[model samples]
Target: MANHNDRSGEIVLAEDKAVMAKAAEWLREGRGVALSTVTRTWGSSPRPPGSLMAMNDQGRFIGSVSGGCIEEELIDRYRQGELADTLPLSLGFGVDNQEAGRLGLPCGGRLQITVEHLNSVTSIDQLLNRIDHGELVARQVDLGNGEVRLLTGDGHPELSVSDQSLTKVFGSAWQLLLIGDGQLARYLARMARMLDYRVTICDPRETFTDPDPLPDVDYTRQMPDDAVRNIAARPRTAVVTLAHDPKQDDMALLEALESNAFYIGALGSTRSAAKRHDRLAKMGCSPQQLERIRGPAGVSIGSKRPPEIALSIMAEITATRNRTAGVAAT
Candidate 1:
């Protein structure tokens, strides 16, 4: 499940973000803090480029750059004042095969790390605020002085470093809008949340109820169409209809089709999908717009079980996300 750019599990990324937030909090409290980032990697490094780790003056740390292998050493260096300067230092690990083996790097894997001694609590607070409000921001750091600047970011590389400076982009967290509260929707919501997607379930029907409500997910009684419109559209947003009832699914699909959501899907059979397409067309949807709805809602995995179906759906969404990123990069 690991992505090419980072670890596979969304929970890991969530933890990394939490670490960044904590680091900012510590800085605001006037404590010395250092942020270590994986700037580059080669030959099977456990962490990918742009992975983050943060530590405070108290020697407490969060997140990871080499899983559990290199963190303690970094902390020890910081505590000894070897990294107390205001400038950023680029350090390398696992460059030697024997050292790599001793450090538990996989097969001589190497990582280029940038450690920044942060002194600007105001900048850190602003960056954290921007991220909390769903802004994609690029942080540019001067390697010589440790000065930082935050800029609005479009689609760009997440991390780029040169001899003089380092620049990294942070995007808003992904979100998922589910149009049903059925068993299948429950499984999908759980999976999506594990992937770091902010999940919201919308259903006006009183028939759907869960004894164990999901943590951090918003369950709304708003009608599907109204909910979709209220959420609006974003490039990282995804909308899915698992209600199987036309009255709910169709209205939601119509609104979602017009939004900026990157992925829109509905659950149904081939015949039902065709009928829904026709109905949408009759409602004035263009041919190209109609094609945006991914009927059957997943890759063909021949899944009959709820969890299996949920996996297929997430797989398709991941594929779509990767493809979109590729296009944006080009």
Candidate 2:
């Protein structure tokens, strides 16, 4: 497992954010810097699909796109001043599919990256500030001409702004959808926030009435079903139901199970989980769908305490996400 403090190859916009921030500061200190982003990738590529790294003229570097496949060449470009143009340029790694095996990428993945020269105006300081303030921003970087524009939206790309062009969104890693307001939920929310997951807590009953206890979570009194219905789960979102009641957990699970959420889990015990499944079965959920419910939702580490259980659950969720990313890379 990579240390949380180590930023190498992290699937975080903040990692790149800090890199860009430091690069801008370096430029202020009279250092020229260039930033490279992996805008699109296909088949067996390393790193997340949209990872960014920056390099300064002094040969200092941060972040990564591949498992060291192109980092050396990028550093060389900076050293020799090969990339002086401000426009974005595309570079390919490995080989074509027919010759992929010989080049080392078994699946023969190719990546299209955009590298831009960073100056005072073209820097991402304002964009990074917005993301730090918990705002989901969409940045349209024209690959054809290398112009970048920032817009504030709910983190979804709109229709193509122009024909025959490329646009990308860069901010935050993913969102965490949590259902329940118990002490466990509070702990999980705090931990998830530290991991940079945007967390929303849904519980209409107001079981945990005091809002001050959970300042980091976005508290909502909407019913689980209604709340789940309100947000469209994406491939980057994780949904977890901590409320023990079937009435609360079932509806949320039903809605989440039908979505594209990367992780869908609920809290329960062996006997309790079996009963929960039986109730879902009686409620007309098919066996295949019932299997989608990850009950006793954590790795088997024998954690009985609330905080430890939350840790285990978060660990499971993160591990699931990493495994999914690795599969996508391959």
Candidate 3:
């Protein structure tokens, strides 16, 4: 396999939607490749367990495992074709004082990484296909033989590594729905994309126009309720209404409050939130459902600018997604 020179110094994210696809593509093109995953992390590791990266014989790679030093070491070894001959094997870094210092590992941090040599692209291609189609699948790699098993459905933890094998769940990208295309929405959409969310902006008003539109986010002119229904709300979806207009925001909230969406938020003040709740109650929303909508949405950051508001909103959404329970200060 010939080494490709494109993107010579770029560091790609394994968390992005493209890693598995890119891995499959590299294999199909006859490159000698290996997939590396952070199997376990102990104490403040840079990347968490389940983080993935793939390296080829040319030292070209995508994804990250640590604070660059680990990646460089792995790349150097792979460049010398050291990893391609192995059945799946585990490599540990930062076990002791000297090793931690040498590897630039954060103090007291250690990581266990598994590297799997690839000879066939079929499994990767299948994994990519299923996730792209919105299915949850688990990839199990036998530690002794490098054999891979792809299982559909859930019940597996995000990452599990036993003595015999390692299993990691792969799912469709998380989705974010914004009920407006205003400046606040634009900033939120941009930030959400950075977090690997498939963001969509829905605005039904024909009179509304964005002076600048961000790329890679979908736009729809469908009514907010219709948009929610069509998106098929799931546990990985979040809905935020930034339209400001009561009619538009309330319509989105009605459907969002009832759906499987993991997070639902709206922009407004405390008084405005109370008034909106009354409207929702008259509209037949139950108390429980009303509680799901985080109005005056976002942690109170005293944000007065559009960007800061967007940041707080995204932070709140992330907290909800991670199930970080607390008496919300906002």
Candidate 4:
């Protein structure tokens, strides 16, 4: 299957990769292109502040800046030759309820859209290269003249827009490391990918782990503690022990709790979780470090099966990730 997200189903948070890649493709195929970004929004909006969409002269497109209507308007304008002359065009929609209704925007919603005539081919290639290398970066555009800059560093997944330019990040935003490769771990891996998380499964015990490995996830035969350390101990990463055994779970927990991973969770019953914590305490873990472990590791969803439990754990993980990023969970 074809995928636009850089190396689709392999990595996470290449949200703009699809749009950017499609724009590059159409350009290679000799088509006029216009790129748009939702710079600002107020009130109820379908897409968020940093949403992106790219369209070509043939009215073909990828990604979206709104639920649907905004793309239609931009495509219609492009087809009519009304967009090319005013290259770095700024337009507004849904200024009022009446306008919102006519444009199919949510009531009281307003979107500040900046559309640019595409020209920076080399910049797009370089941006994609950086993303492939896993460096957090942003592509900023000068709305006045279409100059694009690829900045290096801890780029946020959100966008910041001023009247003169728009800045947006593209790269891995979150990662999930599972300490086991059991059936539940498989379920969690798939579900986590659906949420755009780079997923990895680590289990040294081949006989103990699931025999069938998922193709998209990175499967490692490393010991649990080493696996925890192997991943970047950053705030955007999550470590969860789904092995349900002290041998595997505790090793991961010891390393994960000491690291700065945004979410650290363990799968088990309350009694089992308490025992795991005590076992770690005897192994020199401080109370505060032990306190950080989410035992019984999930929302209280009364989950009793593999998929349901995975869902609950992901819910807790998602909430933690959002909070760590200073974003409200919707």
lDDT of each: 0.80, 0.71, 0.80, 0.78
TM-score of each: 0.77, 0.64, 0.80, 0.81
Cα deviation in Å at residue 306, candidate 3? 1.4
Clashing residue pairs, backbone N/CA/C < 3 A, model 3: none
Report the error of model 4 at residue 215, Å.
Answer: 2.8
Q: What is candidate 4's CA lDDT for residue 30?
A: 81
Show where candidate 3 strays beyond 4 Å: 1-18, 29-32, 75-87, 95-105, 131-136, 142-145, 153-165, 282-284, 324-330
Distance from true position, residue 181, model 1, in Å?
1.3
Per-residue lDDT value at 27 in model 3: 88
Give the per-residue lDDT of model 4 (tens digit) for 63-161: 677775566777888889888764488888774677678766678777878888887677778888888888777787877877888886363445666
- Screening candidate 4 with a backbone cut-off below 3 angstroms (N, C-alpha, C), the clashing residue pairs are none
**Ten residues in sequence with the least summed lDDT for candidate 1:** 2-11
- Candidate 1 local accuracy as lDDT? 0.80
RMSD of each: 5.3, 7.1, 5.3, 5.0
Q: Over 4 Å off in model 2, which ranges?
A: 1-13, 17-32, 37-50, 56-79, 82-169, 325-330
- 56-165 per-residue lDDT for model 3 (tens digits): 77767877777555787888888877665679878998756676677666667788898888877888888878887888787888888888899964555567778888
Clashing pairs in 1: 2-8
- How would you order the candidates by TM-score, starting with the best? 4, 3, 1, 2
Q: Tens digits of per-residue lDDT for model 2 on 179-202?
A: 888789888989998887878988
Candidate 4, overall lDDT?
Answer: 0.78
